[model samples]
Target: MRRVLSGLVLLLAVLAGTTAAAAEPATETVHYTFDGPSPLTDVSGHGHDLTPVSRFGGAFTTVAHNGGQALVFPSPCHAEPCPRIALRAATTTGLNPGRRPLRYGASVRLAADQTTKGENVLQKGFSAQGSQYKLQIDGLAGRPSCVLVDDRRPQIHAAISNVGVADDRWHTLECRRAGSRLSILVDGVTRGRATVPADLSVSNRRPFSLGGKGSYPDNDQFQGILDEVWVRIG
Candidate 1:
């Protein structure tokens, strides 16, 4: 009887441990396949709508990519002024991950001649306010690289990847913020990382913008095809 009681106690302890682990919050993921209806919608059931900024003067279309459909941003240049394709959500309440650890992933393919200066791939927040962060490619020194910028503080924190992204090729890009460390990954490989404040929070009242900041000009627009865009937070 004593031995059976001891075994039961150990089994109960193990079950309790497993239960606690299961109680932890699961990773929340928002994926945008861009294969939905016109105007693009988040298929992850998050109900985030992608709206185009008409003032930028660029149209969003679906093009071919990886044997499927992907959102394409044609050059926004006409003659004198070439605005970049801009699309963003009206609110960041359920879209943003707040101050918790989060990861942003996307499969992107740049156009053959899409090397525009200061072109942004993904960003959240405005330039006027100090609470903004961005994940960009090839916006630094005209090189094909991944850049993560955090502007929540007085000094801007940027983490740039060492590997250069090839043009006209599909590549998986990811930026992860775990604790105080921000890491940039290319094709599932960690390329760059920067140490930020542990309490650094990316929370902002502004809406989350994609392709580029809504208030900014076309110089920072993104000229490429983006697919499988997702944001995971825990």
Candidate 2:
């Protein structure tokens, strides 16, 4: 009888351990889906007087031929490849920047034939003049696949890379920042790890984009589909 009781207790302990592991905090999702003739209308505090660019400009829009709206840059700051998807820290109306201990994740469909040049699909510290940090995705340019840089030391800090992520297909990439340690995920698998400065914050007041720019390929135009961009805070 005592042996039977002992076995039952052990089973109960194992079940409890499994439950605890399942309850661990997981990455959450924040999506800004887009679709329409006026695709930028989904964002708040936007006005009608702003100049329009192509079919996918303003705040958000669906302007690509891939049956989904994209963040389009018809006429970029410089001038084919200039199309891009950008994110800015807009606080006029004051929306809470989600939770703390933030992690960023995204599922993107990139242009199959051509991809971002000079580095990886992920680039940081992107200012028209210059930036403090940069994460370059170099596989798009026929280079070895890896996260190019972690440029967030001074003002810009903590850059990550999902090394095996490729364009022309849907991929899920994630970056987790816990204290000073950083972990990157590509296709739902952890690919790289790094230590970041405590003072590092990659958030810039300027807007950041995907697909198009002025630095490479005449204009940095992103030719693809992107969806399910999620920023999680632990």
Candidate 3:
């Protein structure tokens, strides 16, 4: 009788442990569907407010994309000292996903006449010197490509897509970092992947900029339309 009782207790304990593990909170996900009356706000209930980096020139305007509103960056007066939109300080604090896995995705459409070489679409960090990660539609070899960079010197580990993305058509670009591997996907297709430090983390007090990095000019500004930006942290 005692042996049967012990077996029952062990079964209950195992079941309890499984239940507890399953009850753990899922990943935190934030999505921005640019449907708004004026200035855009994150509809993901994450409280991330998009603000203009500059008061004047670089402000984003609302345009239609896929039957929804999208943020558009008009032609800038100059490539350097251009205006940009971003979420700074307090707004970016919750983006710290610790050392766990994270993913960033955006729906972008390049202008038909896009002549710029390096147009930054999304980035998290203060400047090139302080960059933790960045995703840009750049013309590295005189051809448009989607590039993803982490905190690496010379960026040799940066992931570059095999196909060009600046076709003036809407495309979904995504970067996912899991364990020590980083993968870049364009339109649900894997573009490239690279191995990064297992302990790589972007948990810092830096502004998460869209359209471009606030400090850099010339190559970091994005001139196009952006919609449905999403971020997930596990």
Candidate 4:
């Protein structure tokens, strides 16, 4: 009976160890698949829905891509008020990663000809204000980069990728913030990385913007298709 008791205790200890070593799943802060009529709807049950604020009525629309629906922003936008969407700062909840490990990304498809001066895929807060997180395709290169400014610091931590994603192919681009490290991933592979402050935290009262900032001449508009945009905070 003593041997049997010892064996049971050992089994319990091993099971406990295994449970402790297992990884915990990240929480879905907000997600938009852009697969249905309600493309701007946040299906993650977080109620972080977006509102379209484009000057051109047809700037924001849906197109079929990759065996599913994808949100489309006018190529070149040509003029001001190019396609854009936003979530109000007051309504944005569980979207800020304050000193937390965060992962946010999107599936993008852009032709080379669609490149713009700057394209904002996702942004919250403004760098000028001192605390922000932005995922944007920079310059005419169409290379995605992740920017972080935390703790009201004026300095910007940018992780820029060399790979241009405007080849008319569906590529998954992700920005990961793990402690002091920030990384840019293309197609599930790390393409760029930068070291940030270990205690850096992003918390601000700024509306989340996508595709572009506004109807300005230089909204940094995105000219492409985006799908499965998500933000996960852990």
Q: What is the RMSD of candidate 3?
A: 3.9
lDDT of 4 at 115: 87
> Can you write out model 2's per-residue Cα lDDT over 53-145, one digit (the tens) per residue?
222232334555447665533332334333334343222211112223556554555543444453323333353433322333443532212
In terms of TM-score, which candidate is strongest?
Answer: 4
Top-lDDT candidate index: 4
Ranking according to lDDT, highest score first = 4, 1, 3, 2
lDDT of each: 0.69, 0.43, 0.67, 0.80
Of candidate 4, the 10-residue stretch with the lowest lDDT total is: 82-91
| Candidate number with the higher lDDT (1 or 4) | 4
Q: Give all TM-scores, in the order shown.
A: 0.81, 0.51, 0.78, 0.83
Tell me model 2's lDDT, rounded to 2 decimals: 0.43
Tens digits of per-residue lDDT, candidate 1, 158-211, equal 667887664677888888887788888888988888886777666566766667
Candidate 3: what lDDT?
Answer: 0.67
Worst 10 residues of 1 by lDDT: 140-149
Worst 10 residues of 2 by lDDT: 90-99
